[model samples]
Target: MTRLRLLDATRHGALHLDRARGGARRRLVPLGRGEIAFAAADMPLCFAKDAQTGRFELVALLALAGENNLFTSPAGYHATYQPRAAGLGALRLDPAGADGLAVDEADASLGGAGDALFTDGSAARWQAELRAVVDDVVAGRALAEVYARRGLLRPLRITLTMVEGDGQVLDGLYVVADAALAELPDADIVAMHRADELAPAAILTASLAQVERLRQLHNARYPQQIATIGLAVAD
Candidate 1:
């Protein structure tokens, strides 16, 4: 599985990414009016905006190729993988499934006509908060501090751009409010279900503490829509 992250560098006109594990570093090239930067999962990329550009919002999308890629060879596997249509029907159902389930679509546009207020929020602050969570997870520390720092009543949006196993693009928007670690299951069973149902078992079980924390936060705070995306935390 591969995860993708998009950072808003328009504010500063430049963006920088550093891979947490491979030590691969990237500096942005010039971007046009509607451009952004992308980072892949193997690389725990983090970015900062250049001070020379005008204020702009940074948006991130974490995309993952389905687990258990059938082919052994990278070339063969990639060749076999293709984007397919993600049936919107499954996502549009009302709040009633076998287990009292419900599905709703997420708002994926960065800042369309009515999203000016939300777009004004700074990505730098969110990036810093995520960095802290990453740092804590790498050290095997608890995420209580990070959870506490977030607004208790406000929901935070986390965007995801997924290319399903069949190759259809699934754009997701996750709004996280409060989060807790796996040890504290009472804090978020719904979130756990979302993680478990959508992600591979091995991936969920091996996730960093911070990943669980984010899930918990999203479950607790999100007012609408179910979260199907989970972060792959690397050491």
Candidate 2:
């Protein structure tokens, strides 16, 4: 009789839970579609609900534990209540499971990674354009600004460190692509970066064309691996 609830920071919403069974006849609750926050591949979660009050509670049991004492369950659930002394915070659910949870307080302070992006007045126009590009990538459509918004679009920014010229030092660059562009590959990404080029920071303002190109490059270079791009929006 276990139920679950999902508090997703990405979509900034809640989701209904689905029921399931894990090992040992334990009941499990799955989150709904698009219910995750940032990265789905590394953040699995689970929860149980009180039959009477109907308030869903996060389950603290760890399906997988690491040497560092970090624990991981399925997606949509969090282990925040666990003690910080245990070093278990380093444990992550599947990246695909990152939905339905807020960025942990510890993670929020690490600006380059694990942070969400915000936008303000000065960057509003660029933000709108980036959002359209993201929408197209998520929808599996081609990129055309014909239906794009004229002004003030809010898009997320994802940054990553790459060895650009000689692999001497890591160059941190921002990719102002749609949030959905996280799965794209590097070569194709290279092209998109060229197109959606942002000034001062060289962040790529990705569009559908850029996503497609990145996908092709990704397939050619690293076929089996998935890439995660960090996101930060303007305030």
Candidate 3:
């Protein structure tokens, strides 16, 4: 049996590994979102050596974002956290070129404080927990105190759920960049929003499955269009 090897993102780009084939093998492919685009880029990945093959197989803890970030909706789509460009509070990315946005793989200052990242074993559970924390934060809870207790750099999981919205129940995770942006009633459902505009939209992003409940609703234009939602710290 092959033991699972863990990899952390030194810089944000796509989660990729240095394959034995002399080329990089992508683990979690980035969805071109601005904030996480740089942070998840070309970082040094760590892994354990395979005793039999005498090689390292690296795997990223996070998953890649799906195209359009759209999922199935029966009662119509409810609001979820929308992706946006990184604002003032957004985590900064390393310079790609000598003066560009690219991160230098050789930079010692990169990957500062590896403690901010979670290992593969706990990534999924942590993601769900982060979403719960966001719910508390949205409901008139203090972010500073919560973050201080839990620590920041929270990872989020994009999910689809069945909940009431304007008398209609939608099956998908509805979130916003800020709690103030949410127009839905507080009692309607849990609204997961970010405190800062600069913070990455959703962490460990994943696309919801297309609605396949009834055959009559299986139309070509069902999913609508790809929304410009941004994501952060995808699993």
lDDT of 2 by residue, 16-96 (tens): 111111111222222221222211222322223346854332222222111111222333223323211112121122223
Q: Candidate 1: where are CA atoms >4 Å away? A: 1-6, 9-122, 141-235
TM-score ranking, best first = 3, 2, 1
Q: What tens digits encode model 3's per-residue C-alpha lDDT throughout 1-235?
A: 1222222244343322111111111222112222232332322111222358543222112212222212123333222221111010012122332111232233222243222323542233333433443343233123222222322222334332212211222211222223332433454223333334223333312121112211112223334322222223322
For candidate 2, the C-alpha RMSD (Å) to the true structure equals 20.1
- As a whole number from 0 to 100, the lDDT of residue 117 in candidate 2 is 30
RMSD of each: 21.0, 20.1, 18.2
Runs in model 3 lying further than 4 Å from the true structure: 1-67, 71-82, 86-92, 96-98, 103-220, 223-235
Candidate 2 yields a Cα-based lDDT of 0.27
- lDDT of candidates 1 onward, in order: 0.24, 0.27, 0.25
The TM-score values for the models, in the order shown, are 0.16, 0.17, 0.17
Once model 1 is optimally superposed onto the true structure by TM-score, how far is the C-alpha of residue 36 displaced, in angstroms?
A: 33
